[model samples]
Target: MNEVEGRGLCLHNNSNGNLITPSSDDDLRNVFHQIRTTKNPAVINYGASWCRVCSQILPSFCQLSNKFPQLSFIYADIDEWPESTQHIRYTPTFHFYRDGERVDEMLGAGEERLRDCLWLHS
Candidate 1:
């Protein structure tokens, strides 16, 4: 577990998922920058540990990351990074970005919806 800026959050590097947790405002900005600059599609899962739905769908989310190697997958905790989730209204919101722009957004923990968005965007 790699700590970022003493935020208590760890950036998981395990092979189970390539998900990244932005621990600070700058880190979050860098992630957005990468999403904008990268040619590949990017998806960010906005969630928190306390959210039951988030926890339930996390495994599926990680699986999706492994399933889609071409897309960049990220996990952002709304409680830890409020600024990054100002516009987020739901716990497990998935934002899809392509060509530096947000092409789609899915709210809730529905696996099928998430997969559909990924399939369409990624």
Candidate 2:
């Protein structure tokens, strides 16, 4: 199987509260636009499967996704999207997007900090 398949990072049907991956910059932009059009903010977790910090934050990330269905929860793998890497630094970066524009970003995997940021954004 491919590395993407092994990491479970490949695209799958996105139901409510599902994680979606956008391959290219255009695709990522489209996803951001779609989410912004809904008027609710989006929380994008740019993570890598091999990163231990990312793995630890998955449960909280998953819970946040369910808690805020109005907000789009996107899981973007750094390794998968090289184009976006330049914009963001660090392994697990949290970006809040609204109106197709980035409103705020919180880097790293501290649960409390993430929660606080999400609360502030939403």
Highest lDDT against the true fold, candidate: 1
Against the true structure, whose TM-score is highest? 1
Error of 2 at 72 (Å): 0.9
Backbone-clash count (model 2): 0
TM-score of every candidate relative to the true structure: 0.83, 0.76
Candidate 1, superposed: residue stretches over 4 Å from native: 1-17
Report the number of backbone clashes for model 1. 0
- Give per-residue CA lDDT, model 1, range 22-90, as digits (tens): 767678889998888875688999877778898778777777877777788888888777877788888
Residue pairs with colliding backbones in model 1 are none
lDDT of 2 by residue, 1-122 (tens): 12343575433334464555676767777776687676668888988888888878866776666655667777777777767656766879998977667899888998888888877777
Off by over 4 Å in 2: 1-5, 8-15, 23-26, 35-39
Residue pairs in collision within model 2 = none
